[model samples]
Target: MLRFLDAGESHGRGLCAVLEGLPANFPVNIENINKELERRQKGYGRGGRMKIEKDSVEIISGLSEGKTTGAPMTLLIQNRDYENWRLKSQEETFVSIPRPGHADLTGEYKYATGNLRNSIERSSARETAIRTAVGAVCKEVLKELGVTIRSKVQTLYGLNDTFCDLFDDGLYDLIEKSPMRVLRHQEEFMALVDSAKKNGDSLGGWVYASCEGVMKGLGSFMHYDRRLDGILSGALMSIQGVKQVSIGNPFYIATGAMYHDGITYEDGKIVRTSNHAGGIEGGISNGEQLEVYCYMKPIPSLLLKLPSIDLKTRKNSDSRYERSDVTAVVPLSIVVEHVLAFELLKEILNTFSRDNKEELLAAIEVRKIRIGEIYEKTTDY
Candidate 1:
């Protein structure tokens, strides 16, 4: 029953989010939440806005002494750039020419607003800041239940040069330092980013996310609506500009080999040897690390202008340029992690049906015992 809603415009005073249904006595980490926000603001090709805003979250309610109070949690992220936008004249207002590939014109039409400024303001990527905050909270909840979510950029604009030895200790470090969050061929990827920026264009990329320590059978195959994969995909696709989703491999290789993870037994425990199904099969988690990959389209608001029709005049015109990132895949990856964390938390809560951290952990322990008993009696793979 966990849910959240975010409100505010890109250049408004700030963004606000309200999260409800989180259990009481769950530990709240303000610093870690702030760090996630900071991560979302990083990445190569970011524009002047990143330079102006130092994002921080203010917890206004539902937290007391670093623990949830079982009430709705309200968060605030101030827009430091609001001062610069505050004094603009109504006549010298922002552009009315909606950029192609952006939500500007459609939002204006849907909201019945003649001015496109209102459309772009709310549809901006800036709203992801609040979502990051809410995801951070969900991360805290999952952490309490021994679940961890991490993400890294897989490729940048089809450049796969950032690959380090996947097993090397330096892989994590390299990913953390990378502006594109790529771990493979650093120099080549950097070159591509530089070239894109020089041309006033943008780049797209992919991200790989892994979740460890999630227990099996957290979702039910009995009903399609209750499926974990459906929930995860829906949550991920909600992010703007996400073009594709992959559970594990982007392409299915096996023709008639089931293409699904089969159950097995190991050390008197039910498990699977290979996770071709990406830790899920039959719409449920199978006690394996959940792997998800997302493809992000390049930022739509390009620095170089494009063609568009003026909303008022209905005449073709050059689209107006706005300060925007040349690439947002890196930050988008972090945002993806936050959203996935939220979905995982929802699934866990739905399966365990606990009201607090202690109760949830106890319920999980009991389920583990039940699975262990079943494992001992089953001999077939």
Candidate 2:
């Protein structure tokens, strides 16, 4: 039942979020949320905007003395760049040309607005800043439940540097030390980002996230919406520039018996030898690390514009140029991690059906004490 929504523009006054359904007595941390916001703006190939914005959250409601009040929580992130655009709102600004890869034209048509500024303002990935803020809170809640989440950039450009083990528990600290959040370092990746920046182009890459300490039976197979993988994939797909999602291997590199995991009984407990299914089976979590992989397409904003049609003149022209990153894969990995955190937090709450923080904690303790009960229900591999 945990749900939240974000509002505000890319360069608007500020970004805001209203989150509801959190139980009373759950401690809130503004500093942790700020730290997560800081991570979202860090990367190897970020733009000038990162330098301009220092995001911090102000809890407007539903928090009293650093604890939740079981009411709707409101968060505000003031836009540092809003001062430049504040005066321009009074005048009708029109972007004659629509960018090819952005929602410029489609959003205009859908919203019945002629100015593409309206589309670009809200459609910009900058809004994900607040979403990351929301996820930071969820991450804290998950931490209390003994669940941890993290993400890594698997590869940049055309490199297939899958050096780290997908389900490694010890990689989180190392990945945090990385500028790009990946295990392996390649000079070629850095060079590509620099070259792309100088040449007015952009690059994209793959990111993977893993969740540890999730108990079994968090999702249901009865309904499509209730399925864990479906919900996770949907949340991941909503990220900007993300083109595809994979639970395990997207190409299914395995053949024959290698495609599935082998289950065995060990010391009176059920154990999974391998996790080819990425921890979820039969639309529910199976008490293993839940892994999600995503492929992000290159950012559309480039100094070198592609061919586009002018909305006003009805003539072909180069797309509008904007200051943008050469590659967002680094900070994007953090975004993916936080999004995954929110999804897991919601699923845990919904599955546990707890109405308060004490109840939720007790329920988690119950699951931990009875982990073998779920495993005993299904003995087959």
Candidate 3:
């Protein structure tokens, strides 16, 4: 199975992720990985931590001369802000009251810990940095096989009408240029963010992600656990602050007949009139672009605190506030993109002959031929 285990606290020495199950001989570019890390750090409304930590991945193992050797890959990302936090110590940063909309309360209750700092450190979104590095590595592998994944912020604070389509031409460029990662309403988003900051509040939004060039039948319908949509949904929901996930525009109101895609043929290739199904059917990829949208909640650590009770003092108190983004939905697009990429890579590996890179590519080509033959025979009949 393709998987990774991540460790280290948000403000600890650094973060570490060990990823395994990739095939041998695939090339890796540290620079490309670092570029992805940099992308995750960008976006307006970010906190001072972003300015302090410059994320770059170091490969501790699994590659020989920039190529995979079929061993577990070890990735390390040093926290530049670690030294600053280290001097403060956990006692100094101890938390008595939990933050609202965060794991602090539940985690403290579950673990029976008095200090919420134990929960806060691990539950922080800062851990996504290492996960993003893993996703970047998966992206390189997927790129070699002609797959491309991308994502952008589709809405900010429930303002959806001004967003751009994910498949629009030059959408990526447009998102890169905008601080909010939206194709339109850049000024409005900035203004709202400024206002939220002034009011000591935070914002939430939707991130739309898509993967192109994934072949059909990557997942099996025979098993519920093996369904592609189920797997992808689980992965997306696992991200910090992500509360809702949909394969496509599931929220759109339509009749059963109008909601689904219509199959058609164009230029001797099968196509769909609409992609409302988001490129998946019956828990399997249907040779269409895989599209997903995730709704991330506002950052829990607000300058305007919520009501809570202090564990130490046994008295009513406001929730603890930490340094956090006014809105992280912009960089969240990057995280969503990479998270989907990693899941897709895992699905591809699970479905194909993946002992090595060459074998995996040949298997994919063969699967494509088989699909073509099946379609051709059915069309002829």
Score every model by TM-score: 0.94, 0.94, 0.97
Model 3 per-residue lDDT tens digits across residues 208-243: 888889988888899899999999999989999999
Residue-by-residue lDDT tens digits, candidate 1, 106-132: 897799777788888888889999999
RMSD, every candidate, angstroms: 2.1, 2.3, 1.4
Candidate 1 has which clashing residue pairs, if any?
161-184, 161-185, 162-183, 162-184, 162-185, 163-184, 163-185
lDDT measured at residue 308 in model 2 versus the true structure, 0 to 100: 92
Those runs of model 2 whose alpha carbons end farther than 4 Å from true positions after fitting are 89-92, 165-171, 370-381
Steric collisions counted per model: 7, 0, 0
Off by over 4 Å in 1: 161-170, 256-259, 379-381
Summarize candidate 2's per-residue lDDT along 1-381 as a digit string, tens digits: 899989999988999999988877888789999999999999789999999999999989988998888889899999999887777744445586888888888898899677898899999999899999889888877877888877888878887655566456576667777676766664667788889888989998898777888888888999989999999999999998899998875646877698888888787687898887988998999888888889999999988969999877888998987768889988888899889988888998887878778998898778777775665666552
* Poorest stretch of ten by lDDT in candidate 2: 160-169
The model with the greatest TM-score is 3
Instruction: Please report the TM-score between candidate 1 and the true structure.
Output: 0.94
Clashing pairs in 3: none
